[model samples]
Target: MAKVSILYPIFRNQQDVLRDLKTIHNQTEKDVDLLVLDQRSGKNKDSKSRVLQLFPKVNWIEKQFKNIAEMMNFGFSRAASDLLIYMPPNIGLKPNLVQAYSDAFQSSGMPGMIFADYAEVLPDGKIEEKRLRDYDGDITERGNFGYVKGYSLKAAKAVGYYDEQFNRAEEYDFRLKLSEHHDLIRVPDVRYDVFISPEKASEKMSVGASKLFYPGEGK
Candidate 1:
């Protein structure tokens, strides 16, 4: 079995997905399988074809999804490896990132997730360090490093899978489920640059949490 199975689902973000395709193709560990679920159809067919051309070896599946969570779950269902790593379309992996993940999973012998501190790079090339607790508002009180939203992969059949109901906070929900079964680890490695485009990433802070999450549903 391949050591890792990477699940990356794409919507209209063709350009960013292409960049990630190259990163996966260049991975030092060729023992990884990549499953890309293309979520664009009709007018974007040509662009979708172009994106698939970049990754001929990938297990490509096409279907429109209501949201990111559904698309990711679709990709996860097609995965064949024991370990499933879910990442966004804009994240860039280092050459040894998969190898590192495989090593971590092997050495740890614990069925759980593992993530690292990531460096966020802007389109113009400015860089900033991001952490799991950055947006929590109580940074000093929180640990410096831990599981972020979702960067690790546990046993594919274990911990269930991503909850499709969550448009956002899917990682938060996944961690909650994972905590009940296994330990989560934060590896101190800068393995990838999770690039978030300014327009999509820098949304107004004034946007209410209800808007960001589920609205009109009391917690």
Candidate 2:
């Protein structure tokens, strides 16, 4: 069985979906699965056909829900692997991310959550690996872990998955809950690449300004 399952909750972004899919398929860790939870149903279905053609191996699951948190919760509940990484569409992954995450789990004695630093990719092609504030509730409470990701099924079930009540900042609340029991470990390596887009009204929906967009960030 694959050790890692990357859950991608996609709404709509065809411009780079195919490219991103290829980036993930090429990860160094062969024992990994990518599950795309497609929420772009009916009139909003834009990139479905293209994605299927470019990446037939991807496990595509379709559902209609405007709430991002609920979509992520569904993905979490359905992940076949014990460790799942909740990510969004159009982001790039480090070739060694899956292997790194698996190793982190083993090294930490299989902790509930494992996260690493990330290099933010700007439109201008500048990549910066900003230092992350290692797992601290007070800091986490004010701002979700910037680029960290991943959680174990055992630990997730104990605290309950992302709260549907919060489409925004759902991760912040979820991480805070898990912090009560499990310790959020940090890996210094940069594992994920996040590209910032123009501001949209949806950005405001985050539970608060201090929310994690990636499930990996909640912790």
Candidate 3:
């Protein structure tokens, strides 16, 4: 089996999916399993064909999920490796991301979850560094860590997986639960870049904890 499995959720953004796929394809870590969870409907056939033609090694699954939590739960269940990394469709990864995660997982005694700092590509093509704070058990609920994260299958299952009832902030809820039992390790290196449009960048800067956690609620 592969050393780590990447669970990527692909929505309607085909270009983003392809870009992320290319980055994953060029990773320095060779012993990696990639599972593309395509949340598109049957009418959207182009993504499947294009994905297959480009990255044949990717294990693609086309299914309709009720929410992000449900999709992630299903993905974790199907992951071949105990160490699972969650890669969103909108990020650009460094070549060493997988390798870094693998090393951190092993060296840190396979923590419940592992996350690292990331750069953000702004609307004007400028890059901004986002250094996430280390895990604080006392303020876990109020903390807003960046989106990209890695999970341990055993730890996740022990917490009963993600709460599917939440339409948003499912990850935040899961992290809180996971932190209760296992350590949430933070790798200090910048491993990925989040491409942000003008609107998103503005919202990101102006939003408070409520808006940041449960996005699209006030819209």
Candidate 4:
């Protein structure tokens, strides 16, 4: 059995989907299973077909939905691994990231999650520091940690999967909930190059800004 399951919920970005899939497949640790959830349905048939051709080994789950959270919840429901990583389509994995996560999981047991620092690359190729804002604020005083960045897969069932109500900051809220039970360690050795696409950033901002108005509705 794979030690970790990477749940990638795909929408309409066919151009970069293959690259994302390839990045996960090329991870240093071979014990990770890539679960690609196709939420594009009929409109994404061409994209799905292309993805299947590139990675026939990947476990593909097709769903017709406009709600991103609903599709993610469905994907989590189908995951078979104890550890689950909820990630965006634009993020690329750095070497040893999976191993680092696995090692952290073994060391801490239940409620332990391993996250790492990341570089935010702009369209002009300028790199900026990326900070992970969760719960109250940056938990850097927690330990052996650099600045926090990127998503993580750890103790899925124990931490409780992403809330379907939050299509935007689901990972943030989920991480906050996980922190309640598990201690988050930001490993400096493992890092991911998270590209901030203008389109995606805009969409996320819109969802995040509106989430405040909705309150617990996002939970």
Taking every candidate in turn, the Cα RMSD to the unseen true structure, in Å, is: 11.4, 11.0, 11.4, 11.6
Q: Kindly list the per-residue Cα lDDT of model 2 for residues 1-219, writing each as its tens digit.
A: 677788876665445666666766776366677898766664334566777777666788878775766766777787878788766554445445445555666566645654534434333433333444333322122233434367777777787887767643455455545544443323232322222221321352345435334435423
What do the candidate models score in CA lDDT, each in turn? 0.51, 0.56, 0.61, 0.52
Tens-digit lDDT track of model 1 for 1-219: 777777776666456666667766675366777877776665456655776686567777777888666765665666666666665555444344445555655665566544444433233333334543343322112222222222334442366666768643444444444543444333221222222222322241235222333322111
Model 1, residue pairs in steric clash? none
Give the TM-score of each candidate: 0.60, 0.63, 0.65, 0.56
lDDT of model number 1: 0.51
Candidate 2's error at 79, in angstroms?
Answer: 0.3
CA shift of 100, model 2, Å = 1.9
lDDT of 1 at 161: 69
Q: What TM-score does structure 2 among the candidates reach?
A: 0.63
Backbone clashes in model 2, listed as residue pairs: 148-216, 149-216, 150-216, 168-206, 168-207, 169-207
lDDT of 4 by residue, 54-158 (tens): 777678877676565666566666666656666555544443444445555555565545344443333343333343332222222222232323333444455
On lDDT, the stronger of 2 and 3 is 3
How many angstroms is residue 17 displaced in model 1 relative to the true structure, after the best TM-score fit? 3.8
